[model samples]
Structure formats: C-alpha cells, structure tokens
Target: MKNILLFIALTLSVHTPLKGFELQHIVEPSASMISLQTQNLCHSLYEQKGHLVCLPWSNPIVDTGKISLLAIAKTNEKGLGIYQRARDKDLNQSFLEEVFRNENFQDISGFAEARALYKNTVFSIIPLHFAAGFKLNNPSLPEVHFIEQRQTQIKLSTTWFLDNPLTEEWMSYFIAPSIYHFDRASSSGDYDVLDSATTPYKDLVQNRSLKGANADLALGWSSKILWLPSVTVHGYRLFKESSDCSTCLPTYISLDSLNAPKADASVSWTIDHSFGSSVFGAVIQGKRLFKSIDQDQSAFAYIYKISRLQSYASLSQNQRSFGFLFDANLYQLGIQYSNEIQATALQPKRINQSYAYTALVL
Candidate 1:
C-alpha cells in the first residue's frame, strides 16, 4: 500500500508546476524486507543555482562632449571544472548535461573589477584620455583554484584626427602608453594545472610578480557614407619597454611569446536617421580569420539608440550577451547579461554572468 502511494505522488509531482522538482524512487516489497530509494535532481539541472552575484558592470561608448568621465564595477562567479578538457572532442548539450549530473557544482572561482576613465579634447582636434583599473581573481575551492591573479593598469592616450578633402572622409591615429602590474600564483598540486613539461615556457607557470610599461596604437578611417563603415585597427604592445625593477616582466614574455604584440580590427556602421542612431559592427581578434573559428574571440555587435534609450546585443565565441542603457542628461545607467564559456584544463564550463554600470558626464 505504501509503495502504491509513493508512486502516485511521484506522478503528481512530475505533472504539476513543481515539475522541475523531479523525484525518482524505487520501492521493493518482499516477505521479510522493504527497500526504498529516492533522489531529487532539481539542483543538478539548474545553472547559476549556487552563484553569489553583486551587480557586475559593462558599458557602451557614450559621447560626453568635451570632457567625459566613466566608472564601472563588476563581479563574476562560476562553478569550475566544467569543460576543463581539449576542444578536439565533439560535445553536445546532452553530453554536457550528463557530465554536470556528476558534478558537485559550487561557486569555486570568479573575478571582480573596478575601473574609471577620463577623456577630453585638445584644440578641438586632438582627443586625450586617461584610465585606470584594478582586477582581482581569488578562488576558494581547492579543486578549481589552480591560479589566482591580481592586476593593476593605468593608461594615457592622445589621438589626432585629420579630414580628407578629396575623399570627404576623416583619418585618425592614436597612441596609448600604459603601466601594468600583475601577480600570478599557481597551485603546486596537480589538480587543474595546465603546465606540463611538454608545454613551452612551463617554468613561467608558477608564482610570479611582474610590472612594466607598454604602448598601444590605433589607425582609423571614417566616411559619411551609410554603407561604407568605419574601420579601426588596434595594435597592443606596439612599443618595447624598459623596466629596471626587480619584479619587472621579463623581456621574453613581453617581447616574445606570452605577451607578444597583438593586432585586431573593428568595422562599424553608423546610420543617423529620423529615429536616432543605429550602429552595428564586428571585432575580429585572431591570427587566422576563417580557418580556426573556435580559436578566435571574434564578435558581432549591434546597438540601437532612440533618444535616451539604447539597446545592444553581441554574440561571440562561446558567449552571448545583451543589454540596455538609459541616458539621463547627466548620468547614464546600464545593465547586461552574459552566458560565457570558461575554458579549463579538465573541460570547458559554461557560466552565466550579469553586469550593471553607471556613467557620469563631467
């Protein structure tokens, strides 16, 4: 009689609004013994179940006239050890679900950042900007905390814009110099470690402190045509550095492999119509554009602004994000949501994150 009652309850739970609270059970009745088994799978099936969030931050470019100021704060948390493996294997949603079923999911790793920037125009043709930011990443879970990093950055830049009379377009060039500091600490244990003897520069994988200066450069072209988009190419680490400090980053990493110079391009189309402004573009960052799509951090983005309301969406490698912004004369408020793929040594895990930010025009 008890076994029959339990089966009836299970049927109701699966069909009701509490269907997600699925329960599976087995009941055996024998002459001398009764056996019962039960399990609740709701928590295992949901993502972001145990994550702790504190309003992260993200933003879109806002023209704040001659002088502009912006500030941002954000935090991201995720259950580690999801896709901590090589990408060579074929993976599907069902496979990921099965793997997650066996995981003791917990918020074991994440990062937080605080940033601010100031910008102004010089002689109505040169743009000058200053920015500084700090980021911290400390994971408490030993199973996933293979590396912890803290970073500090400060940058100053100036841009020169010149108009082309023949082409009726504008060409701009910018150079930014920055001072950066970082401390990386790695676990001595074998768990979740990416460093191996076979891997190049394995020695640099352990605990280290580095601080140095580098510069970035950008060249851009803009036209008045609706279909002819603006194009910008950015180069990081465009200039070498000289650091005498003991903890300064070695030239090998800065000039050679790890932090070698990198370049990427962005193309954006802007149309100002009766409704407002619509901008859409793509940023591609990789050595190979089409050959290895998965290895690139390329992204397609679109933004629509009708007066004080702005909406944006972006889709990129293993991530999708969308957000909305409201501009109120002096201050702007915005919020965003992102579903990202966090790469790890054991496998690649999917993480859901959110961000909120506000900016002020000074």
Candidate 2:
C-alpha cells in the first residue's frame, strides 16, 4: 500500500506541471499576437476638433492646414521590434542580447502618412483631399519556439467637405478602401504521446497566411447647439465578406455574419475658449453596445488643448489610457500609457503598456 501511494503522488506531481505548461502553449503566441495586432490597428488619432478618430478615417485636410508629410513610430519598454534603428552602433553584442532576452510577448508597430488638399475643387466648394499611408504590426514571443506573426496594411483615401470646411458649423464625408495581409505561425512544441493521442489535442499546430480588403466610409457633422457649446456626431462603417473578415477590428468581431453591414457612431461636445479647446465624447456601436468579444464596444474620451499642447485621457469597460502631445510647428512629440486586461493561460491578467512617438510635420 505504501509503495502504491508513493507512485501515485509522483505521477500527479510530474503530470500536473507538464499539463500546465502544455495549456500555456496552447493559447500563447497566437492569442498574444491577436491582442497586440488589434490594439495597434485600432489605435485612434488626435484631431483638431478634439475628437479621437481612427487613423484610417482621419481627415488630413482638416487636421493639417496645408500639404502634410508625417512619419510616426511607436514602441513599448521592451525595445524596438517594429522600427529598427537606421544604424546600429553596437551591432554585434546588441544583436545577441536581443535574441536571448526572456521576453514572453512584445508588440511593435509604426506608420507613415502623406496628404494634401486642392482648392477650387470641381467636387464641392470646399476642397478635394487625398491621403495615402501604410501600417505594419509585428508581435512576437522571443523565448518561445516556432512563433512568428506579422501584418501590413495599405490605405488610400479621398475626402469631400461642405458648408465651408473652416466654418464654425460644417460637415464632411470621406471614403477609404484599404488592403491588408497577415501571416502567422505557431506551435505547441513536441507533444508527449499521451497528450498528442488525446481527443482534442491532435491539432495544436497552426500556420496561416491570410489577406483581406475592405472599403470604409465615414460621415461627420458638427453644429452649435442653441448657439452655445458645439456638438459633433460621426458615423463610420466597414464593408467586407464574412470569410475575409475573420480578423476584422475588435468592434466587428462579435458579428454573427459580416454580410450584414454594421456601423459605429460617436457624439461629442466641444467648448472653444481663449485658452484653447476642450472636448468630451462617447462612442456607441454594434448589437452588444456594452461589451464585445475582446473588449468593450463603447468608449469615452476627454481631451483638452492649449496652444500647441494637447492632453488626452479615455475610459472604457476594460481599459484606461492617458497621453499628451506637444506640437512645435514642424515637429511633434507624444507619449501614452495604457492599462488593460490581457488573456492568459489560466486567467486574465492586467497589462501596463507605454507608447512613445515622434513626427515631423511638413
């Protein structure tokens, strides 16, 4: 009896720990990759109107007074994984340190945009605007084996405004068609025969190469309410086939079918003062107005701008972030801190993230 009890105790100890590691491998790399990719792609941009708008739908003509050329880079504390240094001063030793780092997961992304507005337009009394940009997202787990993920997006868009774009009360509309491609490879390492032969553990390896194209549109209107504070409303939508939308934005992940078009709306109140500008707003969208698959469908923001400086802070069901930007005519610098929930093997964990960016404005 004593020998049998000892054998059982040893078996439990070995198998339990191994099982935990196996479970972690199952949801790792890919799960972390998806979380980072979605956040990077959906990050919003700051607008003069004091509203937070997604990068793809931003109206460059209004955001920047004239022809604009901008380059921006973002990264976390782990190091630069997306935008590498132009020239490495310590190439040999630094390269070795990067490979052996015990980074469980990391996200790196960046983008560049160029835009111009043409006056005396044939389309409308306002101006015809054109913008083009590209984005790249890379997330990885350095210590994990056989793990790789990358995504690239290209955007080309045009815009038309009405009722004098510069006026206090105005409206604008824009359309953008974008294309993106993503590649991912991940595995759970060599599985033990006991686990591999199990019913649900047979398929623990995945290699996917996918591409998608989507057409997006947005309509925005702002007016003085009772000649007091100004109010702005915006509606945005995306059109795509169901299969192609397997990896759509977080807002659309909960849709039963992508064939049914869905749109999101946001409303904000702006107060213009001698000091600067202030805005408060909330976004609403989808069948699940409160929560979505990975995050809350609704979001809120408060922004204040004075002179060439702006401060932004936001809140949602599961995330909070704060950031500030300084505009020095031809140059801009910004940094943001984010706190959000991230999925893990056993449970959910809260992640504290930081982002720093710089841009040159032409």
Candidate 2 lDDT over 1-362, as tens digits, reads 47954753453334211112111111111111111222222223334355433332333334334554443333455444422532454445455444333333343333444445343111111111111111111223222222233334344445444456566444333333322222221222223334445635435333333455444454454434423322222222244333533542332011121123344455556666768766666554332221222234346767677888877777765557777778787776777777753222311344456655555545
CA deviation > 4 Å runs, candidate 2: 1-56, 62-74, 78-108, 112-149, 162-205, 224-237, 241-263, 285-297, 343-347
Clashing pairs in 2: none
Cα displacement (angstroms), candidate 2, residue 25, comes to 22
**In each prediction, how many residue pairs overlap at the backbone (N, C-alpha, C within less than 3 A)?**
11, 0
Q: Which candidate is the best by lDDT?
A: 2
For model 1, give the 10-residue run with minimal summed lDDT. 30-39
- Each model's TM-score? 0.53, 0.52
